[model samples]
Target: MKGTNYPNRWLIALAGIVMQICLGTVYGWSVFTKPLMAAHNWSNSEVTLTFTIAIGCLAISSAAGGYILDTKGARIVATIGGILFGLGTLITGYGDQIGSLTVIYIGYGLVCGLGLGFGYITPIATLVKWFPDKRGLITGLAVMGFGLGSLMLTMLSPGMIASMGTAMTFYIFGGIFLVAVTGAAQLMVEPPVDYVPAGWMSPIGKKSSDGMTLGQAVGSKYFYLLWTMLFLNITAGIALISQASPMAQELMPSTMSVGEKAMQAGVILGLFAIVNGLGRLLWASVSDKIGRRTVFIILFSTQAVAFYFLAGTKDMMMFTIICSYIYACYGGGFSTMPAYAADIFGTKYVGRIYGWMLTAWGAAGIMGPMLFSRIRQASGNYSEALIITAVGLAIALVLPLLAVPSKAKSKDAKVA
Candidate 1:
């Protein structure tokens, strides 16, 4: 936004993804569940709480970071986020050595969660500012690193845990997180206030492009509906994600050895992460062409059916496809919502506004894993849990119709 020393906006996006890759490691929590339990003798539910707490903290911290991003800019916020995340991981490793869940909770959940929140918001609104003509695609690229981060970790983490044990594994990764995030933070910057692409033209009557403050967005009925839609989408996906390794191993034929079963489950889980990243790119790109609302309808509707079929499938091939579909759609929500908001509310204030919207992800993080764990404990299987999610998705299919806003229908529809 200043002298033309470094005016390449795409470079800023690349930097954003580098930091996001480090932050996205949260989704790989399942990879740590067994190791944490075995190392510490914690119950399944107890180990699960770390993820829940982290996501809850992520949601709350992200909301605050968005405000800070709007006020202070991305570099300082992201640098601080890096410090906390790396420190949290280092502390979590120490917590493991001492067998202290409280320490792990404070470090990994509270401190790392803050890092995730701030880091998550750091790049989004900045990218939207730099690439107004490519909002969906740009945000998708910036966030896709997050999904890839999970995929990469899911593949490598088990080996790290097995070879180094959990404590040293945390120490090594913590150091990496610190270096990667802090260095990448240097590359992030807001565009000049009057910045626009060389030949980009604002779409005629693009309602969301009109500037609206946080107060204006919060007062609208559609905001609540959008929140509910995000909640339902995440709950269905994370329910399966929370217990995917265990559930997949169970669904594998009993003839396989325990090691074989675990390996196979890891492969499937890895694929879910891969497609999760790809889906963000693919679906968001499609939204640019077809409109966000229609693409979301297809995403939610397809996943609803996928969840139902997931309950009935015994074959690994079918299960893999269905779960990947669910994961892809689940990921689609993250990329779509930010662009959708900028489309309706204007890009100028979307950084903080989108941050406020992520609370649904926080709420769903708590709901999804707990729902999956509780239902499995009660029923001794994931079938009932799958059916419940299927039902939730079926209901979610109708919510998006109410969520989309047309500029011509009512100006300032929310305030009205």
Candidate 2:
């Protein structure tokens, strides 16, 4: 490590945040849902499927992208992801102009989803290696942009749609995304071998030690527990997210015009997006002081209570408070999980390990939105779906209690 002149690590972190902010706009899918539905005469379930497919593809792509990132490097993968995402968005706009739902799905759901996966994993995996000394805080900071990306798009999308129309808006955003994401990705690179921050010592007195491989990690009970916990948390949180705008509007008095309702819902959605981003930074940093498992426990317990209140709330103010809390905990799970996996499986293979763990995200993306949409369509309200998510969260609370940390070894990991 001597004589090495490292690029400023903080700049790498900045680049990662910028890329994530672009990728994170997928969370703003709900903002486009009603418009798309009205434009295409698609049902809620049909429109929601675009988001589901994008996320499903994101999980699959990220799983594969992790290996490429670990072996080939972060810059290439992120750049490719950026290109794919921007291209996909452009394609979606073109598909809209032609009125083809299938084309839109391919553009947004499949193409953009793949891009999201590749772009998303690059930062977390790369930053984990660069900042082992501040694993929790750094990973949190890296992903905080992703959480906030939704807010940026949410605030901008409505006005943009009103002024330019959805397709043109998508076209413009696509160009911006292409420029922004790839530009930032150019700044990303892996640290040198055996890199360490100046003045910091590894508590173990080694540059690096043996860590669990992807196979070894998958063999452990810890992996399964973490995966299931993530699944449950995402399932509950995303159910609301997929429908947040319309659901908020549903609670409004009938006297309000459609535009007014959309504006109010946009405001609430914007607030949720803000807390979602902040929660990542707040909870992940807190996990450094407490423990990762303890942080997850807190997230689960508090979110469970919030969901219980959310199931029946009709008052807009009360509804906002409850959803914001749930959003925080939901975002916390994401930021905390990377650190948690690093602690259990070791940072060496966390890219692969955590990438695979995101399959839970794919599954939840499909399950949460589909289930929420179906229940709403059938029952004419979100109450039943909200209650179901509450119960799921309550059950998930037990998984963290069972998740005890274990040491990573060069040999195959045990079921502990």
Candidate 3:
């Protein structure tokens, strides 16, 4: 592995960032919740269910995308992802035009979710191969686009909706995503098969090599432990995310008009996005220095404290600040987990292995909010949900301790 072309490979990262920015619009779903509720008379639970479905589909599709990425390569998988995502968005617009909840579920929840899964996997695994020397930092840089993507759309979507109405907003965004994602996909090709950095060494250890296929990886005890830990962390993080806009409004000090509340909540969402992006970069870079496992332990411990007190936050600004911390830890998981997976399983089949691991995220998306939604509905407060999430995070802290080292043979026995 020599003669690495530094300039061109960075272009792949640029394309990845562009692609992720488009796919990240889903994080802005909270902005649309009230509009859907007013339009269709749907309950909060029904509306939030779409988020659950979307992530679940994303998890499933990502698994398939990983397999395709490993076997078929990144370009085709990304292209297909773009097409599916754009089409799903377009059809979601159709659902909005007709004011049909079921249609929204199918188009936005299931279809577009599939696109996110495939689109997400491409850059992550590709960059791990391209930038083996900077796994944590490069992965962080590539995914920071995903975190800020929510901010971009949060700022943009409100204006689009006001000018064009909710239905047309989807149409325009769909067109943009189609063009942007396809263009990015063209640049997502794999690097030279035997490439390595100009001045670098294997990170985990001198003898560490890329390990096991998906089958073998699943068989390892570390897999289940890591998966459970990931699941708990994401569940707590996503609870706030799925409910952010409304929660922000509720936490405000005094009674206000709907417009004012919406405006302030939007600002909070923007803050979350900014912090989320920064967390990806900041924490991932930290992982490179202190190591991935250590970073996760830190992530779990910090979030556990935040979640416990979040239930008691009364001031709007303080609420945003605390939730931002939780969101940052959430973003850290996205950045840290890939690097960690590569370290453990070898980068040989990291796309697939990490995709499987993301099942925890998907599961959390589906079930994590149940407690919050139910608790909020019954008690008219998020305190119980916060306490429960905190407890979950504390439990997750133990998983890292139980992660016993296990190895499987790779084709080259080289850890990526």
Q: Could you tell me every candidate's TM-score relative to the true structure?
A: 0.94, 0.96, 0.94
Cα lDDT over the full model 3: 0.83
Can you tell me which runs of candidate 3 are displaced by over 4 Å?
A: 1-7, 203-209, 253-255, 404-416
| lDDT to native, each model | 0.82, 0.87, 0.83
| Backbone clash numbers for all candidates listed | 4, 0, 5
Clashing pairs in 3: 209-414, 209-415, 210-414, 210-415, 347-416
Per-residue CA lDDT of model 3 for 25-52, tens digit only, reads 8888888887788778888888888888
RMSD, model 1, all Cα superposed?
2.9
Residue 377, model 1: lDDT of: 80
lDDT of 1 by residue, 1-416 (tens): 23455468888889999988888888888887777777778987888888888888989988999999889998888998899999999999999999999999998889998888988988887888888878889888877888888887788877777677889988999999999999999887887666657767655554224568998988887668777877888778777888888888877788997556656666778899998888888877777777777777887888888888988898878888888888888788788778777766787788788899889888998999998888888888888888888887887878778776766135323211
> Across residues 293-360, which tens digit of lDDT does each residue of candidate 2 receive?
78888888788778888888989899999989888888898998888887777778777888999989
Per-prediction RMSD in angstroms?
Answer: 2.9, 2.7, 3.0
Clashes of 1: 4
Give the range of the ten consecutive residues with the poorest summed lDDT in model 1. Answer: 407-416
